[model samples]
Target chain A: MSVTAPKGFKASGVAAGLKTSGNLDVALLLNDGPDATAAGVFTANRVKAAPVLWSQQVLKGRAVRAVVLNAGGANACTGPAGFQDTHRTAEHVAAKLGGMGPGQVAVCSTGLIGERLPMANLLSGVDSAVRKLERTGGDDAALAIMTTDTRPKTTVVEGDGWTVGGMAKGAGMLAPAMATMLCVITTDASAGGDALHEALTQACRVTFDRLDSDGCMSTNDTVLLLASGASGVEPTQEELTEAVTKACHDLAQQLLDDAEGHTKKITIEVVGAADEQDAVEVARSIARNNLVKCALFGNDPNWGRILAAVGTTSAQFESDELNVAINGVWVCRGGAAAEDRSKVDLSGENISIVVDLNAGKQTATVWTNDLSHAYVHENSAYSS
Target chain B: MSVTAPKGFKASGVAAGLKTSGNLDVALLLNDGPDATAAGVFTANRVKAAPVLWSQQVLKGRAVRAVVLNAGGANACTGPAGFQDTHRTAEHVAAKLGGMGPGQVAVCSTGLIGERLPMANLLSGVDSAVRKLERTGGDDAALAIMTTDTRPKTTVVEGDGWTVGGMAKGAGMLAPAMATMLCVITTDASAGGDALHEALTQACRVTFDRLDSDGCMSTNDTVLLLASGASGVEPTQEELTEAVTKACHDLAQQLLDDAEGHTKKITIEVVGAADEQDAVEVARSIARNNLVKCALFGNDPNWGRILAAVGTTSAQFESDELNVAINGVWVCRGGAAAEDRSKVDLSGENISIVVDLNAGKQTATVWTNDLSHAYVHENSAYSS
Candidate 1:
């Protein structure tokens, strides 16, 4: 139950012989709509990918009919030719979808940047996916966009008379600004462009934005939401936002769980900050610290590295007032040693770290993964 | 030749029980005064160690008689008690040196943070070091202040009629705003306090300030310059600065070559930027990127990662006009793949990366080490 769990949506995935392994690398999602409303978020990186630039322009129309994604080539930094390839790919998908205009289609790609896509293979695969589009193909679509991710990530949230569903793919190069990920979310609730944008923004701000598996922000991160009012149930804005956020949170958790070479998933909860922004900043700083992540991998409750990372941030907190707890044990209190390090158990796959800034009432939680030898191996050998 | 290469300086290193390994963990550098003009730079970390705080105050007096260093504990985040320990250590060293004032002593420590120093063992070691102090003890003094360093780092610069000699120790937790390092530089030049301060500032601005080993800034980074004027050579401010910068650059290069768990030394040169600040910013962003570092470790000419990193900075550069070269191969020209990636060889211990923005004429170079599994292993297992 994923993107297709919502009404008026069909998805498919197929191998295009583009990936060297001959794995499924092409995915398509279609909105069979009486009314199509869309919203999207793209990478904040200044060097936007060709597909991201194309999709941003397409979303300006506030309507979308189809989404075509390929994983064998990222289609980024390929100059004007890259943008032309994206335009042709979108137009091809629109033409194959029975008279839909090019402006109604979105194109996304992930993999090696600075390389041209195999247009023949990608276009043929798009046609195959459009022909095989089925109501139960969401899982396959999720599996298709992955690079180094170990599993497909999909989630569905059911409302009283509406549904929201999503699928996301990413592993390495996962940081804020949505990571090196491609996400497709669908809803069957009656919503306009403004409502869709508001809901998607609110949903992603606390969900996908909080997952920082690594400190590397990608050049090709995109998340799109398509709403088809075919269900005839007009949900309120609050209800739509809640459902979308829940679905996104579920999918984001899956991404972290399946992140490359990670053995431990850490939930960093920063509390007692001056404000939510301060909490988020402090949490992000701690989450991105390689030394802290390495200690997490070794299961060595090293709170000193945690404090050292926090010190680097401009967040509100007195050095001596900070406290840290790992796996339910307060390892540091008042910035000094508190509980016994031996009391902290890190044998489980999930690690909980609580940092009390002791400044104010605001709080935030960021999710991250530990730095492991396998992470080094996967990334170092990835391009080769 | 090192810190002792300069006249009017005597250095010594002694083993203290502070280290469980019973290695040399204490060092003393005494400036024989005809004029003890001093200037120093310290870590920018807000959560500074007690010794840093003490040394900052000492530098304000523009005079220093001795420098005491320990390696077993950082004496950071230890609250007022840590400050008291640093204060007492300074006073003890000053007392043993024939009634020198505590304000004339600058104390430095590098090791585990959030721990108090063992006062009894540290003071005893200071006495022992003073008893063994000699003019030729620079190498021993360099060796004493090491935590995970593989070898002692020392440099000497011979001026027209004077000399600048220095010793530095740091292996990890090194970044701009100084590193988790400690250095003592002694010069036999005839310079006043203001000239010493200006020369030291100018020297460090381009030398120690440009090394970003890991993105982590330390709490105990301190660099001190003591001018004895014993050689009776009065050099120009420019000449003094050039010699000091050369000495610092030599030491900085040594630090990068001996960085913790690194198999290769990387020099990131960002040219054609709008200004030196922009160049430094762009270079630092690329240097700190884990993906780029990983690619370097694998000897992969992944210019895409370099471009992705440059995109994240606010540095002036057109997305399509950026160029990157690995070693001497222009792998990327005009932000697109130009040369064959296989032609770039990374078999050597030194790797040079050049990124051209084509926006201006300014340039900057920063040194860093690649991310390795050993880095994670050493840091994770360090505290345990």
Candidate 2:
């Protein structure tokens, strides 16, 4: 099985005795002192986890030899003690690999927020993870990082003398520019750290930030990149851009597919807005509507709810400039509803709504799901 | 049942077949002028209903004689046709009463949005309602305006030379005060429409506007003030001020209690902020969090989720200056957390979170409820 997959990369995933189900929970990836460069992104949440804080500080130097991660408990709200656990884990991995210092390892943790990590279990887990590192280990590592995701998410985009392989973990609390996605990308491409960071940020702008389903931000969210220069080829900017976009697109879909209790991924397209931001806000406002989500779950054709949601936005458009189309059928025009609403079929798993502001040429698309009883059930009974 | 609840006011509630359920759905109130004065408010939604548009036009003049209301379908998004519906409903009641034109009769309707009024049923309802009008008819009228509301809402406050009585109808999509309240306030204090409109607007600033739970803005929200000059002694402005404040406080609670799927009313208090809006945005963000609501429903002491929500707002508080108190117990301070988390007891129904920004003296309070499966059930099942 490809664990640290992508050409010229080494990865490992181990049980670590952290999960009650004995599932794999700790993973490691090493770049092996390559000319390849690294880049990353982390949650905007102020309540950063111990691992997130530690990794962010290390990444400031922009050079890392390896990446280490664990799941099951987020080292958030754990104070100084949690920070120590993260440093020790990185140290253990570095000592075992013998090619870098603790500062050269980027660390990330995901899962239940505000919980303390079991240092006793993690200490041994890090050592075993380093010992088990191997090529094609990306599959196991992807599985190891998951919390509530129904399946593992892994993608690899091959380039000349380099490869960009990534994995992600997330489901609910998703919205645009990205939800609580904890992503890791590994490439043997020889690019500078600053350049890599810049590229990753650009890719995240549209791919990850546009998904907001539950509208909650997680404390343990993170994204990291590690490069091993074994590929012996420096790729052009164009090649890197194309590869990164493809990888981001793949990982985003993976996250969407695993959205908790979601049976359908509806795309809300807001067209003819004053600008792109207005379209985004209007679509997002509708996407975040609980009533509309519930209506969708029930498979009811409630177009009024859609208009009401759009109306609540503080955006530039009002009732006068609004025109609405659902599934390519115009239901409202010139500030009034279309006389022909019966032509639209809203009772389906896939629902599409287009709001034309008649103000600008820019448009925005937002992905969301209907509110379902299963969502309520999953969240309500989750802790118990 | 003591429906003409306000002193110096006369009201009547009667059967209106506009609703297919054969329930009473029309209400009338008469204020023969005031010894003191009257006031009014309206919804902030840009997509105003026919009645809202008409009532707003009338508000430009300020003096109101009577208010006529019915509940079956909200005449919103009906375009030119919708305005005609509001006109005919008022005209029917005015002709039967033999006192004024349609312009003098304020109108309100609440039920399903986007649907047109059943003219045949409405015309008959208006005739029967006029014949049944009486001074003691406030409670039935309260019941008539309810759509998803489980019960009618009515409150009364007595003033010198006039008695202020009020009735409101809204259970969903309520975050009133920038309007969004379908309310009828009656008094015999003898005031003109301009003064009344000013007071009504002022009172609503804190009362109706502060009660945002669902975040949805209704197209048909309106609040009408009728002055019946039965009271000979004119009350002072100070007296009206006190009455309006008290009315708002009580009604805000009523709206909170009536919020959808709310088994528990959670108050989020953000204190020590730089300003009121900053505190308000922080509290509002937390109140609007679906994950936080679900966690509350599960009785999970998820303060981390609470802080995460606060960080997302534009509030002027930093993580380091944050101090969190759940159910009156301080659990976090500075940039880390304390062991007092055990003090939070969400084991019961009501949950209260006190976040002391410790950064400023500003404060704001927001009310919300836990997300429950029953809420999903109710909204998903309802149509028209």
Pick by lDDT: which candidate is best?
1
In candidate 1, which residue pairs get closer than 3 Å at backbone N, Cα or C atoms, i.e. clash?
A: none
- The true-versus-predicted C-alpha distance at residue A15 of model 1, in Å, is 0.8
In the range A1-384, model 2's lDDT, one tens digit per residue, is 322555567788899877777999998887765453677777787667788789888888888878888888777777777789899988887888896899888888876656678888988888888888877678888889887788888888888767788888888767533324688877777778876877787677667766777777777677676666667667777777777777877888778777888866778888888888898899888888888888777766566777778777777876766777777787777666674667877656677877887777898887778777777767765544
Off by over 4 Å in 1: A178-180, B178-180
**Which portions of model 2 show Cα errors greater than 4 Å?**
A1-3, A176-179, A339-348, B1-3, B34-38, B191-198, B339-343
**What does TM-score give for chain A of every model?**
0.98, 0.93
What TM-score would every model get versus the actual structure? 0.98, 0.94
CAPRI classification of candidate 1: medium
Question: How close to the true structure is residue A52 of candidate 2, measured as C-alpha lDDT?
Answer: 79
On TM-score, the candidate that comes out on top is: 1
Report lDDT per candidate: 0.89, 0.75
Chain A of candidate 2 compared with the true chain A, TM-score: 0.93
